[model samples]
Target: MKKLISMIAVAALLITGCAKELKVTTAENLKVEYGEELDNTKLFNAKESDENVKVDKVEGFDAKKMGEQEITVTFTDDNKDKEEKLKITVEDTKKPVIELKKESVGITAGDKLELKDNIKSVKDPVDGDLKYSDKTVEKDGYYIDKGKLDTKKAGTYEVKVIAADKNGNKTEKSFKVNVKKKETAKKPNGTGNSNTSNNGGSSSSNPSNTGNSGSNTGSSSGGSNNSSNSNGGLSNNGGGQKPVNPAPHQHSITVTGYPDVVYSNMWFEDDTEAMYWASNYEGPNGDWAGFGYSSDQCSCGMWSPYFFNVTTWE
Candidate 1:
């Protein structure tokens, strides 16, 4: 009976030694793409030569959500069971996001249309460096489909902008470009007249009265000097009509002796120096001429005629 017990123990030890052990050959930490299924066969080490050896169960792993997951792999060999627990990481499956900088922009007609300038920027959560492109909706007179603007007609237009990533994920945005007519420049000041006088001539009705001065000197019968008077005038409106807008011109005049200047109450008189304005001096009237006044009006005052170039607006 003792010998029979010894033989039974030896048989049990041989059976236990022949049984195969299950193991996982894959890495302890596995990474899988989102929305992908995990294969149990690839995660386990089973002897393909043995028909009874097979992957029995795989659980505790999900690829739908992005995070760390626990995966339990089990192998069965002839009713023997073994299990392996490991960690896996699931990544996002969604595409990148994109948006427009602005919904609309305004520009004048005949201006260059820079397509890229309108887009604020292209961004992606997973893919930071995204590809971008733009296109015009139509080949209309108001909008340019691409490149520099070719059309100048005033009208509203639309453009499509696209942002894409290497994963074939893409997003689109729309923009409205407004083309408007260009405005013209306005003339300086209002409708007024400019008439200037030269020498001792009196200014009647004149507009655009620039700087001008005039003076008159009287003489006594015995060659003695009489009292002198100075006059200056500025008129913005001349003769109730638009004053002649003269083109810019200049000329000079010389006097050997003082010439008597005719005075008018319409002008302002100065005891010392008088200012002459080209706008009020009609003597030069659309013609080039200069007006002169006494630099200093003493008891014996000297005066001379002045000349300057003049131009008239048509």
Candidate 2:
């Protein structure tokens, strides 16, 4: 009887070891963009303990759909079929694109200026074209950030256009609006007829009087008219010349060893300011100065310090 009990216990142990549960390793709570392609190899493991496993099929996953859903992955594990469920979220995180008609526009003072006219179009990859709005809180459209554009004043004003899509992705672009002073017509001089002789008609009646009158008219009127004409020419010449405002020079700077990484077409008052900005300008990675270095140590495996080249144009 003891020998019979030992055989039964050995059989039970063999059954338990042969029937061990198979646990599949899978990625949990995966997130993908709305239009990303699905790959089975990246989703889950295809082998268990050196045993060959194959992914047979996947279901309930839509690349075009935006939301969270449960996906079923079917695979053959060690000659046995099994299934695993995974939660995946599809989202739209792309920001909208803003195209402006002009980066800088000029208008005469007191002229009508519409802020929306500057925007050429606002388009989203998933949401199509976005509409214009007066307020910034609109989720599906764009709006001007600065309040009340003053076109009546003569000065330069900066305007920012902010666009947002349905998924809360946002993009911003800045532009300038220059308001020029209106020109007015100047009044003609009142001394134009002062050079005419008043005694010419009386001199025509008598020959003796004509000579005296002619001499007096020529002497007095010629001097007075010449003086008036000289002063008027000087005044008109001065008033006709307008003061010219110099255009801002375009400046650019590039990082050493990275030609593609550059800031171009930036406008500045002078080269001094551009140099200052380049010295302290911080980019996506870091500032131009001390690039590829951590404190005093060179992180790029060399003692090479990053240098910059600045170019400017009118």
| Backbone clashes in model 2, listed as residue pairs | none
Q: Native-vs-model 2 lDDT?
A: 0.63
What lDDT would each prediction earn against the true structure?
A: 0.50, 0.63
Backbone clashes under 3 angstroms, per model: 34, 0
| Candidate 1 global lDDT | 0.50
Cα lDDT tens digits, model 2, 1-314, are 99999999999999978984556677777888877778777677555322566677899999868899889987666567778888888988788999987555667779987888889999988768999988765588999976456877666678999998887789999876766566679798755535433422212344565556445545654434322233323333324664467986333333446553343334444332333233343454452322221111122222112233423222
Q: What C-alpha lDDT, on a 0 to 100 scale, does residue 211 get in candidate 2?
A: 57
- Show where candidate 2 strays beyond 4 Å: 1-23, 46-54, 62-68, 77-79, 134-137, 146-148, 191-314
Compose the digit string of candidate 1's lDDT tens values, residues 273-294: 1222212244524342333332
Q: Score residue 180 of candidate 2 by CA lDDT.
A: 59
With candidate 1 superimposed using the best TM-score fit, by how many Å does residue 74's alpha carbon deviate from the native? 6.7
